[model samples]
Target: MEQLIIQLISGAVGGNAAGSAMKNLSLGTLGNTIAGLVGGAGGGQLIALLGSGAALAGGGGDIMGMVTQAAGGAGGGAILTAIVGMIKSKMSS
Candidate 1:
């Protein structure tokens, strides 16, 4: 239960950061928050699959592992948002 909350929060932060960073693509506050949550959760799941012996070993995934994955996703989302912003700026100008 606690772990779930953590992942959800991480995702919200990342998405918000990314959304705000992007120029015209800004998802507004609500949009950003939702994006972050989804991205983080998705990232965490992806990480678990990759880390567990090609996604076959850990039949029972770890909570800590998922948390870390969510963090990575949040970070990635921020970076991606920045990149998108840059591209948009270049195109606009």
Candidate 2:
């Protein structure tokens, strides 16, 4: 639960940051956030499936595990946002 929350927040931040960094791939704030949330959830589940679930959600004091999860979520969010942006640009063009 805590890990999920952490991932979600980090994913949102990552999405916004990526959007700002890549102007051509930037989605509006709301779009980025929505994409980030979905990506975050997906990423968290992916990480769990990859066998990191126990380490991440096992102990309440597992800071490093939480950080790792956050990183995964962030990366997922950024990647998904980029993909969506590319598709949108292509469709518009």
Candidate 3:
């Protein structure tokens, strides 16, 4: 229960960051918030699953832990968006 809430908040933060970092994504405020939530929670789940219990219960769902992971994921996502945006720009012309 606590874990879920933390994860949600983490995701929201990450998605919000991602939106801000991305100039071309234009998900809007509400969309960005939703995206952040999804990204944060998804990243947390993925990390836990890939870590194979190593990340589980070990600050895995904690506020700081989730925020850090979410930030990383959001940054990665922003980078990905930049790459995609560049590719699109180049291809469009």
Candidate 4:
């Protein structure tokens, strides 16, 4: 549950950052945040499925594990936002 919350927050931040970094792929603040939330949840599940959790656990309670998880969430959020934004842009054209 804690991880989920972390992912959600990081995802929102990541989405906004990505939108600002690439206007061509910006989905507005709300859209970006919503997409990022979904992506973050999905990405967290994917990481669990991929067994990356074990690698992180090997560190035995270190900041790196938390950082890695946050990064994963952010990356997932940004990727999804960009993809959706691009698709929307293309469809509208």
Candidate 4: where are CA atoms >4 Å away?
55-62
Indicate the TM-score of model 1.
0.58
Q: What is the C-alpha lDDT of each candidate?
A: 0.59, 0.80, 0.54, 0.76
Ranking by lDDT: 2, 4, 1, 3
The C-alpha stretches of model 2 lying farther than 4 A from their native spots are none
Q: Write the per-residue lDDT of candidate 1 for residues 1-93, one digit (tens) a residue.
A: 443455567767887777765647665677567666666656555654566322222433665555565576676455544554556567889
Evaluate model 4: give its TM-score. 0.85
Error of 1 at 86 (Å): 12
Each prediction's TM-score versus the true structure: 0.58, 0.89, 0.57, 0.85
Candidate 2 lDDT over residue span 24-92, tens digit each: 988999988878877877787688678776587665657778877888788878877888888998999
Model 4 C-alpha RMSD to native: 2.4
Error of 2 at 83 (Å): 0.7
Q: Evaluate model 1: give its lDDT.
A: 0.59
* RMSD vs true structure, all candidates: 4.8, 1.4, 4.5, 2.4
In terms of lDDT, the best-performing candidate is: 2
> Measured by C-alpha RMSD in angstroms, how accurate is candidate 3?
4.5
Q: List model 3 lDDT by residue over 15-56, tens digit each.
A: 566567766663656766665665556655565566632343
